[model samples]
Target chain A: MSQADDLIHQPLRLKIMAALAAEKGAPLDFPRLKAITQATDGNLGSHLTTLEKAGYVAIEKDFVGKRPRTRAALTPLGRKAFRDHVAYLRAVVEAAEAL
Target chain B: MMSVSEHEARGALAEIEAVTRRGQTLKGYRYAGPILMVWGVIWFLGYLGMARLSPALWGWMWLALDGVGFAATLLLAAKAPAAAGGAAGQAMRTSLGMAAGVAFVLAIVAVFPKHDLLPYLALPGLFVGFIYTVLGIYLAPRYAWIGVTLFVATLAGYYAWPAHLAEWLAVVGGGGLFLSGVWLRSA
Candidate 1:
Protein backbone atom coordinates (compact mmCIF):
# COMPACT_ATOMS: atom_id res chain seq x y z
CA MET A 1 0.00 0.00 0.00
CA SER A 2 1.26 3.47 -0.83
CA GLN A 3 1.69 5.87 2.05
CA ALA A 4 2.32 9.60 2.21
CA ASP A 5 5.75 10.62 3.43
CA ASP A 6 5.42 11.71 7.03
CA LEU A 7 8.15 14.32 6.68
CA ILE A 8 6.55 15.86 3.63
CA HIS A 9 2.91 15.27 4.45
CA GLN A 10 2.15 18.68 5.91
CA PRO A 11 0.48 21.22 3.60
CA LEU A 12 3.11 23.94 3.81
CA ARG A 13 6.00 21.51 3.74
CA LEU A 14 4.51 19.78 0.70
CA LYS A 15 4.20 23.12 -1.06
CA ILE A 16 7.78 23.97 -0.21
CA MET A 17 9.02 20.67 -1.53
CA ALA A 18 6.97 21.05 -4.69
CA ALA A 19 8.41 24.49 -5.39
CA LEU A 20 11.96 23.38 -4.65
CA ALA A 21 11.51 20.29 -6.75
CA ALA A 22 10.33 22.36 -9.69
CA GLU A 23 13.64 24.21 -9.74
CA LYS A 24 15.59 20.93 -9.18
CA GLY A 25 19.21 22.06 -8.76
CA ALA A 26 18.51 25.79 -8.44
CA PRO A 27 18.25 27.32 -5.02
CA LEU A 28 15.46 29.69 -4.08
CA ASP A 29 16.02 32.61 -1.75
CA PHE A 30 14.23 32.75 1.60
CA PRO A 31 11.96 35.59 0.59
CA ARG A 32 10.89 33.87 -2.62
CA LEU A 33 10.22 30.60 -0.86
CA LYS A 34 8.26 32.35 1.83
CA ALA A 35 6.19 34.20 -0.74
CA ILE A 36 5.55 30.99 -2.66
CA THR A 37 4.55 29.01 0.38
CA GLN A 38 2.86 31.95 2.14
CA ALA A 39 4.28 30.98 5.47
CA THR A 40 5.25 33.32 8.29
CA ASP A 41 8.91 33.94 8.96
CA GLY A 42 9.23 31.91 12.14
CA ASN A 43 7.02 29.12 10.89
CA LEU A 44 8.98 28.85 7.71
CA GLY A 45 12.30 28.98 9.49
CA SER A 46 11.32 26.16 11.81
CA HIS A 47 10.04 24.00 8.98
CA LEU A 48 13.21 24.64 7.03
CA THR A 49 15.28 23.64 10.00
CA THR A 50 13.33 20.41 10.30
CA LEU A 51 13.79 19.56 6.64
CA GLU A 52 17.46 20.52 6.79
CA LYS A 53 17.95 18.21 9.76
CA ALA A 54 16.36 15.38 7.79
CA GLY A 55 18.84 15.99 4.96
CA TYR A 56 15.93 16.73 2.65
CA VAL A 57 16.98 20.30 1.96
CA ALA A 58 20.19 22.28 1.96
CA ILE A 59 20.14 25.78 3.42
CA GLU A 60 22.87 28.28 2.71
CA LYS A 61 23.27 31.58 4.51
CA ASP A 62 25.52 34.38 3.37
CA PHE A 63 25.75 38.14 3.56
CA VAL A 64 24.92 39.94 0.36
CA GLY A 65 25.93 43.58 0.68
CA LYS A 66 25.58 43.53 4.47
CA ARG A 67 22.22 41.81 4.44
CA PRO A 68 21.84 38.14 5.19
CA ARG A 69 20.44 36.07 2.35
CA THR A 70 19.30 32.52 2.84
CA ARG A 71 18.68 30.13 0.00
CA ALA A 72 17.21 26.63 0.02
CA ALA A 73 17.28 23.75 -2.43
CA LEU A 74 15.80 20.27 -2.36
CA THR A 75 18.18 17.40 -1.92
CA PRO A 76 17.89 14.40 -4.23
CA LEU A 77 16.38 12.41 -1.43
CA GLY A 78 13.80 15.09 -0.79
CA ARG A 79 12.87 15.22 -4.43
CA LYS A 80 12.37 11.46 -4.51
CA ALA A 81 10.36 11.58 -1.34
CA PHE A 82 8.10 14.28 -2.69
CA ARG A 83 7.58 12.35 -5.89
CA ASP A 84 6.72 9.23 -3.97
CA HIS A 85 4.31 11.15 -1.75
CA VAL A 86 2.49 12.59 -4.70
CA ALA A 87 2.33 9.21 -6.33
CA TYR A 88 0.94 7.75 -3.15
CA LEU A 89 -1.68 10.49 -3.07
CA ARG A 90 -2.63 9.71 -6.64
CA ALA A 91 -2.87 6.01 -5.91
CA VAL A 92 -5.17 6.74 -3.03
CA VAL A 93 -7.41 8.78 -5.26
CA GLU A 94 -7.40 6.13 -7.94
CA ALA A 95 -8.19 3.39 -5.48
CA ALA A 96 -11.10 5.41 -4.05
CA GLU A 97 -12.42 6.25 -7.47
CA ALA A 98 -12.43 2.53 -8.33
CA LEU A 99 -14.41 1.76 -5.18
CA MET B 1 -3.42 15.22 5.55
CA MET B 2 -2.51 11.55 5.90
CA SER B 3 -5.99 10.21 5.38
CA VAL B 4 -6.69 9.59 1.72
CA SER B 5 -10.28 10.40 1.05
CA GLU B 6 -11.25 11.30 -2.52
CA HIS B 7 -11.63 14.93 -1.54
CA GLU B 8 -8.39 15.01 0.44
CA ALA B 9 -6.42 13.32 -2.28
CA ARG B 10 -7.79 15.65 -4.93
CA GLY B 11 -7.00 18.70 -2.81
CA ALA B 12 -3.49 17.49 -2.13
CA LEU B 13 -2.86 16.83 -5.79
CA ALA B 14 -4.18 20.23 -6.75
CA GLU B 15 -2.01 21.88 -4.17
CA ILE B 16 1.07 20.13 -5.49
CA GLU B 17 0.19 21.00 -9.08
CA ALA B 18 -0.42 24.63 -8.16
CA VAL B 19 3.00 25.06 -6.60
CA THR B 20 4.71 23.33 -9.48
CA ARG B 21 2.90 25.51 -12.01
CA ARG B 22 3.68 28.65 -10.12
CA GLY B 23 7.29 27.61 -9.78
CA GLN B 24 7.48 27.10 -13.51
CA THR B 25 6.14 30.59 -14.32
CA LEU B 26 7.49 32.68 -11.46
CA LYS B 27 11.09 31.50 -11.85
CA GLY B 28 12.20 34.97 -12.92
CA TYR B 29 11.81 35.44 -16.66
CA ARG B 30 11.01 39.03 -15.71
CA TYR B 31 14.67 40.00 -16.03
CA ALA B 32 14.93 38.49 -19.53
CA GLY B 33 12.40 41.02 -20.90
CA PRO B 34 14.81 43.90 -21.35
CA ILE B 35 17.38 41.63 -22.95
CA LEU B 36 14.88 40.55 -25.60
CA MET B 37 13.80 44.15 -26.19
CA VAL B 38 17.41 45.22 -26.63
CA TRP B 39 18.04 42.45 -29.14
CA GLY B 40 14.88 43.40 -30.99
CA VAL B 41 16.01 47.00 -31.35
CA ILE B 42 19.42 45.85 -32.56
CA TRP B 43 17.92 43.51 -35.12
CA PHE B 44 15.62 46.27 -36.30
CA LEU B 45 18.66 48.45 -36.93
CA GLY B 46 20.27 45.55 -38.79
CA TYR B 47 17.18 45.51 -41.01
CA LEU B 48 17.68 49.18 -41.87
CA GLY B 49 21.36 48.52 -42.53
CA MET B 50 20.38 45.82 -45.02
CA ALA B 51 18.51 48.42 -47.04
CA ARG B 52 21.21 51.15 -46.96
CA LEU B 53 24.62 49.43 -46.63
CA SER B 54 26.60 47.02 -48.81
CA PRO B 55 25.90 43.33 -48.29
CA ALA B 56 29.31 42.74 -46.68
CA LEU B 57 28.87 45.65 -44.28
CA TRP B 58 25.34 44.60 -43.44
CA GLY B 59 26.50 41.07 -42.71
CA TRP B 60 29.22 42.41 -40.43
CA MET B 61 26.69 44.57 -38.62
CA TRP B 62 24.40 41.61 -38.16
CA LEU B 63 27.26 39.53 -36.77
CA ALA B 64 28.18 42.28 -34.33
CA LEU B 65 24.61 42.64 -33.18
CA ASP B 66 24.25 38.88 -32.69
CA GLY B 67 27.47 38.73 -30.70
CA VAL B 68 26.33 41.57 -28.48
CA GLY B 69 22.93 40.04 -27.90
CA PHE B 70 24.45 36.66 -27.08
CA ALA B 71 26.92 38.17 -24.62
CA ALA B 72 24.26 40.31 -22.97
CA THR B 73 22.01 37.30 -22.54
CA LEU B 74 24.79 35.34 -20.89
CA LEU B 75 25.60 38.22 -18.56
CA LEU B 76 22.00 38.65 -17.56
CA ALA B 77 21.56 34.92 -16.96
CA ALA B 78 24.63 34.96 -14.74
CA LYS B 79 23.26 37.87 -12.74
CA ALA B 80 19.87 36.29 -12.16
CA PRO B 81 19.64 35.29 -8.49
CA ALA B 82 17.24 32.37 -8.76
CA ALA B 83 18.24 29.46 -10.93
CA ALA B 84 15.59 26.93 -11.81
CA GLY B 85 16.58 23.43 -10.75
CA GLY B 86 14.68 20.24 -11.43
CA ALA B 87 13.39 18.89 -14.71
CA ALA B 88 12.20 22.23 -16.03
CA GLY B 89 15.55 23.84 -15.35
CA GLN B 90 17.41 20.94 -16.90
CA ALA B 91 15.21 21.14 -19.96
CA MET B 92 15.84 24.87 -20.21
CA ARG B 93 19.61 24.42 -19.97
CA THR B 94 19.51 21.64 -22.52
CA SER B 95 17.49 23.73 -24.94
CA LEU B 96 19.80 26.71 -24.56
CA GLY B 97 22.90 24.60 -25.11
CA MET B 98 21.31 23.05 -28.15
CA ALA B 99 20.37 26.46 -29.52
CA ALA B 100 23.96 27.62 -29.10
CA GLY B 101 25.18 24.62 -31.04
CA VAL B 102 22.65 25.24 -33.77
CA ALA B 103 23.55 28.92 -33.96
CA PHE B 104 27.25 28.10 -34.21
CA VAL B 105 26.65 25.71 -37.06
CA LEU B 106 24.40 28.21 -38.80
CA ALA B 107 26.99 30.93 -38.38
CA ILE B 108 29.65 28.73 -39.98
CA VAL B 109 27.36 27.99 -42.90
CA ALA B 110 26.48 31.65 -43.24
CA VAL B 111 30.18 32.52 -43.78
CA PHE B 112 30.41 30.45 -46.95
CA PRO B 113 29.54 32.63 -50.00
CA LYS B 114 26.44 31.18 -51.58
CA HIS B 115 23.80 33.64 -52.61
CA ASP B 116 21.61 30.64 -53.36
CA LEU B 117 21.64 29.90 -49.64
CA LEU B 118 20.82 33.48 -48.68
CA PRO B 119 17.30 32.33 -48.03
CA TYR B 120 18.65 30.12 -45.28
CA LEU B 121 20.44 33.08 -43.73
CA ALA B 122 17.37 33.57 -41.65
CA LEU B 123 17.94 30.13 -40.16
CA PRO B 124 19.14 31.70 -36.96
CA GLY B 125 15.72 33.21 -36.60
CA LEU B 126 14.18 29.79 -37.13
CA PHE B 127 16.54 28.35 -34.53
CA VAL B 128 15.45 30.97 -32.03
CA GLY B 129 11.84 30.13 -32.75
CA PHE B 130 12.52 26.45 -32.29
CA ILE B 131 14.18 27.07 -28.95
CA TYR B 132 11.30 29.23 -27.78
CA THR B 133 8.83 26.57 -28.84
CA VAL B 134 10.71 23.88 -26.94
CA LEU B 135 11.08 26.06 -23.89
CA GLY B 136 7.45 27.05 -24.01
CA ILE B 137 6.15 23.52 -24.38
CA TYR B 138 8.26 22.40 -21.43
CA LEU B 139 8.35 25.38 -19.09
CA ALA B 140 5.59 27.81 -19.99
CA PRO B 141 2.98 27.12 -22.63
CA ARG B 142 2.34 30.85 -23.03
CA TYR B 143 5.85 31.19 -24.40
CA ALA B 144 5.01 28.48 -26.95
CA TRP B 145 2.62 30.94 -28.52
CA ILE B 146 5.53 33.29 -29.14
CA GLY B 147 7.49 30.41 -30.59
CA VAL B 148 4.62 29.47 -32.87
CA THR B 149 4.21 33.06 -33.96
CA LEU B 150 7.91 33.33 -34.76
CA PHE B 151 8.09 30.02 -36.59
CA VAL B 152 5.11 30.84 -38.77
CA ALA B 153 6.42 34.30 -39.53
CA THR B 154 9.87 33.00 -40.42
CA LEU B 155 8.34 30.40 -42.72
CA ALA B 156 6.16 33.02 -44.31
CA GLY B 157 9.14 35.33 -44.78
CA TYR B 158 11.10 32.52 -46.39
CA TYR B 159 8.42 31.76 -48.96
CA ALA B 160 6.81 35.15 -49.50
CA TRP B 161 9.90 37.36 -49.94
CA PRO B 162 13.08 35.34 -50.16
CA ALA B 163 14.86 38.43 -51.48
CA HIS B 164 14.17 40.31 -48.26
CA LEU B 165 13.98 37.29 -45.99
CA ALA B 166 16.58 38.64 -43.58
CA GLU B 167 14.78 41.93 -43.30
CA TRP B 168 11.48 40.17 -42.66
CA LEU B 169 13.19 38.09 -39.99
CA ALA B 170 14.46 41.22 -38.29
CA VAL B 171 11.06 42.88 -38.47
CA VAL B 172 8.87 39.92 -37.54
CA GLY B 173 11.11 37.66 -35.48
CA GLY B 174 12.75 40.54 -33.64
CA GLY B 175 9.41 42.15 -33.00
CA GLY B 176 8.12 38.80 -31.78
CA LEU B 177 10.90 38.55 -29.21
CA PHE B 178 10.19 42.07 -28.04
CA LEU B 179 6.50 41.40 -27.72
CA SER B 180 7.15 38.05 -26.06
CA GLY B 181 9.26 39.76 -23.46
CA VAL B 182 6.45 42.16 -22.74
CA TRP B 183 3.87 39.38 -22.70
CA LEU B 184 5.93 37.22 -20.33
CA ARG B 185 6.45 40.09 -17.96
CA SER B 186 2.72 40.65 -17.66
CA ALA B 187 2.07 36.94 -17.42
Candidate 2:
Protein backbone atom coordinates (compact mmCIF):
# COMPACT_ATOMS: atom_id res chain seq x y z
CA MET A 1 0.00 0.00 0.00
CA SER A 2 1.09 3.58 -0.59
CA GLN A 3 2.29 5.42 2.49
CA ALA A 4 0.33 8.27 4.02
CA ASP A 5 1.85 11.75 4.37
CA ASP A 6 3.06 11.86 7.97
CA LEU A 7 2.76 15.65 8.21
CA ILE A 8 -0.86 15.57 7.09
CA HIS A 9 -1.83 12.49 9.12
CA GLN A 10 -2.56 14.48 12.25
CA PRO A 11 -6.23 15.54 12.50
CA LEU A 12 -5.67 19.30 12.83
CA ARG A 13 -2.94 19.43 10.17
CA LEU A 14 -5.04 17.30 7.86
CA LYS A 15 -7.96 19.70 8.25
CA ILE A 16 -5.71 22.69 7.63
CA MET A 17 -4.16 21.11 4.57
CA ALA A 18 -7.54 20.05 3.22
CA ALA A 19 -8.90 23.58 3.60
CA LEU A 20 -5.90 25.19 1.86
CA ALA A 21 -5.81 22.55 -0.90
CA ALA A 22 -9.49 22.97 -1.69
CA GLU A 23 -9.02 26.57 -2.82
CA LYS A 24 -5.96 25.88 -5.01
CA GLY A 25 -4.93 29.35 -6.30
CA ALA A 26 -6.88 31.20 -3.64
CA PRO A 27 -4.92 31.88 -0.48
CA LEU A 28 -6.98 31.64 2.72
CA ASP A 29 -6.43 34.25 5.41
CA PHE A 30 -5.46 33.05 8.87
CA PRO A 31 -8.80 33.80 10.55
CA ARG A 32 -10.74 31.85 7.92
CA LEU A 33 -8.48 28.82 8.33
CA LYS A 34 -8.78 29.06 12.09
CA ALA A 35 -12.58 29.14 11.80
CA ILE A 36 -12.51 26.03 9.61
CA THR A 37 -10.18 23.98 11.85
CA GLN A 38 -11.48 25.40 15.18
CA ALA A 39 -7.90 25.54 16.41
CA THR A 40 -6.58 28.20 18.75
CA ASP A 41 -4.12 30.77 17.47
CA GLY A 42 -0.93 29.25 18.96
CA ASN A 43 -1.77 25.67 17.94
CA LEU A 44 -2.69 26.63 14.38
CA GLY A 45 0.40 28.83 14.06
CA SER A 46 2.76 26.02 15.09
CA HIS A 47 1.20 23.50 12.68
CA LEU A 48 1.31 26.05 9.86
CA THR A 49 5.01 26.62 10.63
CA THR A 50 5.64 22.88 10.45
CA LEU A 51 3.88 22.68 7.07
CA GLU A 52 5.90 25.70 5.91
CA LYS A 53 9.13 24.02 7.00
CA ALA A 54 8.13 20.92 5.01
CA GLY A 55 7.45 23.06 1.89
CA TYR A 56 3.96 21.54 1.83
CA VAL A 57 2.33 24.92 2.46
CA ALA A 58 3.41 28.48 1.81
CA ILE A 59 2.47 31.22 4.23
CA GLU A 60 2.35 34.79 3.01
CA LYS A 61 2.39 37.59 5.55
CA ASP A 62 1.41 40.98 4.26
CA PHE A 63 -0.72 43.99 5.13
CA VAL A 64 -4.16 44.87 3.85
CA GLY A 65 -3.92 48.63 4.47
CA LYS A 66 -2.50 49.19 7.94
CA ARG A 67 -3.75 45.85 9.24
CA PRO A 68 -1.51 42.77 9.09
CA ARG A 69 -2.78 39.76 7.18
CA THR A 70 -1.50 36.21 6.92
CA ARG A 71 -2.63 34.03 4.06
CA ALA A 72 -1.99 30.30 3.70
CA ALA A 73 -1.94 28.36 0.47
CA LEU A 74 -1.16 24.73 -0.34
CA THR A 75 1.95 24.31 -2.45
CA PRO A 76 1.88 22.11 -5.57
CA LEU A 77 3.84 19.48 -3.66
CA GLY A 78 1.36 19.59 -0.81
CA ARG A 79 -1.60 19.15 -3.18
CA LYS A 80 0.05 16.08 -4.74
CA ALA A 81 0.91 14.64 -1.35
CA PHE A 82 -2.65 15.16 -0.15
CA ARG A 83 -4.06 13.35 -3.15
CA ASP A 84 -1.59 10.51 -2.67
CA HIS A 85 -2.46 10.18 1.00
CA VAL A 86 -6.16 9.99 0.21
CA ALA A 87 -5.48 7.35 -2.41
CA TYR A 88 -3.44 5.33 0.07
CA LEU A 89 -6.23 5.54 2.63
CA ARG A 90 -8.70 4.31 0.02
CA ALA A 91 -6.36 1.43 -0.83
CA VAL A 92 -6.15 0.42 2.84
CA VAL A 93 -9.93 0.46 3.12
CA GLU A 94 -10.31 -1.59 -0.05
CA ALA A 95 -7.69 -4.10 1.04
CA ALA A 96 -9.39 -4.62 4.37
CA GLU A 97 -12.72 -5.11 2.63
CA ALA A 98 -11.23 -7.71 0.27
CA LEU A 99 -9.69 -9.61 3.19
CA MET B 1 3.26 3.66 6.38
CA MET B 2 0.60 4.74 8.77
CA SER B 3 -1.35 1.60 9.59
CA VAL B 4 -5.00 2.16 10.34
CA SER B 5 -8.22 0.20 10.44
CA GLU B 6 -10.62 0.52 7.52
CA HIS B 7 -13.07 2.53 9.61
CA GLU B 8 -10.38 4.93 10.79
CA ALA B 9 -9.09 5.47 7.25
CA ARG B 10 -12.55 6.08 5.84
CA GLY B 11 -13.35 8.46 8.70
CA ALA B 12 -10.24 10.49 8.05
CA LEU B 13 -11.05 10.81 4.37
CA ALA B 14 -14.58 11.95 5.19
CA GLU B 15 -13.25 14.46 7.71
CA ILE B 16 -10.88 15.95 5.17
CA GLU B 17 -13.64 16.35 2.59
CA ALA B 18 -15.92 17.95 5.17
CA VAL B 19 -13.28 20.47 6.14
CA THR B 20 -12.54 21.29 2.52
CA ARG B 21 -16.21 21.86 1.73
CA ARG B 22 -16.63 24.05 4.79
CA GLY B 23 -13.70 26.14 3.69
CA GLN B 24 -15.17 26.68 0.23
CA THR B 25 -18.59 27.79 1.45
CA LEU B 26 -19.09 31.59 1.62
CA LYS B 27 -18.67 33.14 5.03
CA GLY B 28 -19.05 36.90 4.45
CA TYR B 29 -22.04 37.65 2.23
CA ARG B 30 -23.19 40.28 4.75
CA TYR B 31 -20.30 42.35 3.53
CA ALA B 32 -22.11 42.59 0.18
CA GLY B 33 -25.49 43.50 1.68
CA PRO B 34 -24.78 47.20 1.97
CA ILE B 35 -23.68 47.43 -1.64
CA LEU B 36 -26.74 45.62 -2.91
CA MET B 37 -29.11 47.67 -0.82
CA VAL B 38 -27.54 50.94 -1.85
CA TRP B 39 -27.68 50.07 -5.54
CA GLY B 40 -31.27 48.98 -5.26
CA VAL B 41 -32.23 52.30 -3.68
CA ILE B 42 -30.48 54.17 -6.48
CA TRP B 43 -32.33 52.17 -9.12
CA PHE B 44 -35.63 52.96 -7.49
CA LEU B 45 -34.81 56.65 -7.34
CA GLY B 46 -33.87 56.55 -11.01
CA TYR B 47 -37.20 54.96 -11.80
CA LEU B 48 -38.93 57.84 -10.08
CA GLY B 49 -36.93 60.39 -12.06
CA MET B 50 -37.75 58.63 -15.31
CA ALA B 51 -41.44 58.64 -14.45
CA ARG B 52 -41.58 62.34 -13.54
CA LEU B 53 -38.96 63.68 -16.00
CA SER B 54 -38.08 63.05 -19.64
CA PRO B 55 -36.44 59.74 -20.57
CA ALA B 56 -33.39 61.43 -22.21
CA LEU B 57 -32.70 63.63 -19.23
CA TRP B 58 -33.63 61.02 -16.60
CA GLY B 59 -31.35 58.48 -18.23
CA TRP B 60 -28.32 60.74 -17.75
CA MET B 61 -29.48 61.61 -14.27
CA TRP B 62 -29.82 57.92 -13.45
CA LEU B 63 -26.34 57.28 -14.79
CA ALA B 64 -24.94 59.96 -12.50
CA LEU B 65 -26.79 58.49 -9.53
CA ASP B 66 -25.50 55.00 -10.40
CA GLY B 67 -21.99 56.44 -10.50
CA VAL B 68 -22.42 57.74 -6.98
CA GLY B 69 -23.76 54.39 -5.88
CA PHE B 70 -20.78 52.68 -7.47
CA ALA B 71 -18.41 54.90 -5.53
CA ALA B 72 -20.32 54.26 -2.33
CA THR B 73 -20.12 50.52 -2.87
CA LEU B 74 -16.36 50.78 -3.37
CA LEU B 75 -15.93 52.73 -0.14
CA LEU B 76 -18.14 50.29 1.75
CA ALA B 77 -16.25 47.29 0.40
CA ALA B 78 -12.92 48.88 1.23
CA LYS B 79 -13.98 49.64 4.78
CA ALA B 80 -15.40 46.18 5.34
CA PRO B 81 -13.01 43.45 6.38
CA ALA B 82 -11.55 41.15 3.74
CA ALA B 83 -12.29 37.53 4.55
CA ALA B 84 -12.15 36.31 0.93
CA GLY B 85 -10.02 37.15 -2.09
CA GLY B 86 -10.77 34.66 -4.86
CA ALA B 87 -14.08 36.35 -5.55
CA ALA B 88 -12.30 39.57 -6.57
CA GLY B 89 -10.96 38.00 -9.75
CA GLN B 90 -14.25 36.27 -10.38
CA ALA B 91 -16.15 39.57 -9.96
CA MET B 92 -13.83 41.36 -12.36
CA ARG B 93 -14.32 38.70 -15.00
CA THR B 94 -18.08 38.79 -14.57
CA SER B 95 -18.13 42.61 -14.76
CA LEU B 96 -16.15 42.53 -17.98
CA GLY B 97 -18.50 39.97 -19.49
CA MET B 98 -21.52 42.02 -18.44
CA ALA B 99 -20.00 45.16 -19.95
CA ALA B 100 -19.57 43.33 -23.24
CA GLY B 101 -23.16 42.14 -23.01
CA VAL B 102 -24.35 45.72 -22.43
CA ALA B 103 -22.35 46.94 -25.40
CA PHE B 104 -23.90 44.30 -27.60
CA VAL B 105 -27.40 45.19 -26.44
CA LEU B 106 -26.74 48.91 -27.06
CA ALA B 107 -25.40 48.19 -30.53
CA ILE B 108 -28.51 46.20 -31.40
CA VAL B 109 -30.78 48.92 -30.01
CA ALA B 110 -28.96 51.62 -31.98
CA VAL B 111 -29.20 49.71 -35.25
CA PHE B 112 -32.90 48.94 -34.90
CA PRO B 113 -34.58 52.06 -33.56
CA LYS B 114 -37.76 50.91 -31.87
CA HIS B 115 -40.43 53.45 -30.89
CA ASP B 116 -41.05 51.45 -27.75
CA LEU B 117 -38.22 51.95 -25.27
CA LEU B 118 -39.27 48.83 -23.39
CA PRO B 119 -36.49 46.76 -24.87
CA TYR B 120 -33.83 49.26 -23.82
CA LEU B 121 -35.14 49.44 -20.27
CA ALA B 122 -35.61 45.70 -20.08
CA LEU B 123 -32.09 45.03 -21.35
CA PRO B 124 -30.40 46.56 -18.28
CA GLY B 125 -32.49 44.53 -15.83
CA LEU B 126 -31.56 41.44 -17.77
CA PHE B 127 -27.89 42.38 -17.63
CA VAL B 128 -27.99 42.97 -13.89
CA GLY B 129 -29.88 39.73 -13.40
CA PHE B 130 -27.31 37.82 -15.42
CA ILE B 131 -24.47 39.22 -13.32
CA TYR B 132 -26.32 38.37 -10.13
CA THR B 133 -27.02 34.83 -11.31
CA VAL B 134 -23.41 34.26 -12.26
CA LEU B 135 -22.12 35.65 -8.97
CA GLY B 136 -24.68 33.64 -7.03
CA ILE B 137 -23.74 30.39 -8.73
CA TYR B 138 -19.98 30.94 -8.54
CA LEU B 139 -19.54 32.82 -5.28
CA ALA B 140 -22.69 32.81 -3.17
CA PRO B 141 -25.50 30.30 -3.59
CA ARG B 142 -27.82 32.41 -1.47
CA TYR B 143 -28.01 35.02 -4.25
CA ALA B 144 -29.38 32.43 -6.71
CA TRP B 145 -33.01 33.02 -5.79
CA ILE B 146 -32.48 36.78 -5.94
CA GLY B 147 -31.09 36.46 -9.44
CA VAL B 148 -34.01 34.34 -10.57
CA THR B 149 -36.40 36.77 -8.99
CA LEU B 150 -34.83 39.73 -10.82
CA PHE B 151 -35.02 37.89 -14.17
CA VAL B 152 -38.56 36.72 -13.68
CA ALA B 153 -39.86 40.04 -12.47
CA THR B 154 -38.24 42.10 -15.23
CA LEU B 155 -39.21 39.70 -18.02
CA ALA B 156 -42.72 39.44 -16.76
CA GLY B 157 -42.92 43.21 -16.49
CA TYR B 158 -41.78 43.52 -20.08
CA TYR B 159 -44.59 41.27 -21.26
CA ALA B 160 -47.37 42.50 -18.98
CA TRP B 161 -46.79 46.23 -18.68
CA PRO B 162 -44.54 47.50 -21.42
CA ALA B 163 -45.26 51.15 -20.59
CA HIS B 164 -44.50 50.55 -16.92
CA LEU B 165 -41.27 48.68 -17.51
CA ALA B 166 -39.27 51.08 -15.37
CA GLU B 167 -41.79 50.84 -12.59
CA TRP B 168 -41.64 47.06 -12.59
CA LEU B 169 -37.88 47.05 -12.65
CA ALA B 170 -37.75 49.48 -9.78
CA VAL B 171 -40.59 48.13 -7.62
CA VAL B 172 -40.14 44.45 -8.21
CA GLY B 173 -36.55 44.00 -9.32
CA GLY B 174 -34.95 46.73 -7.27
CA GLY B 175 -37.14 45.91 -4.29
CA GLY B 176 -36.12 42.30 -4.48
CA LEU B 177 -32.46 43.25 -4.55
CA PHE B 178 -32.93 45.49 -1.54
CA LEU B 179 -34.75 42.76 0.32
CA SER B 180 -32.02 40.31 -0.58
CA GLY B 181 -29.54 42.75 0.97
CA VAL B 182 -31.61 42.81 4.14
CA TRP B 183 -31.71 39.02 4.19
CA LEU B 184 -27.96 38.84 3.69
CA ARG B 185 -27.37 41.43 6.39
CA SER B 186 -29.49 39.52 8.88
CA ALA B 187 -28.14 36.16 7.78
Q: Choose the strongest candidate by lDDT.
A: 2
Give the interface RMSD of candidate 1: 3.0
Model 2: how far residue A94 lies from native, Å: 16
Q: Fraction of true contacts kept, per model?
A: 0.67, 0.71
In order of appearance, the predictions have TM-scores of: 0.56, 0.58
Lowest lDDT sum, 10 consecutive residues, model 2 chain B, at B86-95
TM-score of 2: 0.58
Interface RMSD of each: 3.0, 3.1
lDDT tens readout by residue for model 1, B1-187: 3566788779989998998777656554555565567667776777667756877686678678767766776665565544443333443454377457556755776687676655555666677678778877987676678778888888898888988876787778778778877865553
lDDT of 1 by residue, A1-99 (tens): 667788887788888888888776788899878867878999999999989999999999999999999999999888878888889989988888888
Candidate 1 residue runs with Cα over 4 Å from true position: A1-99, B6-14, B82-102, B105-113
The most accurate candidate by TM-score is 2
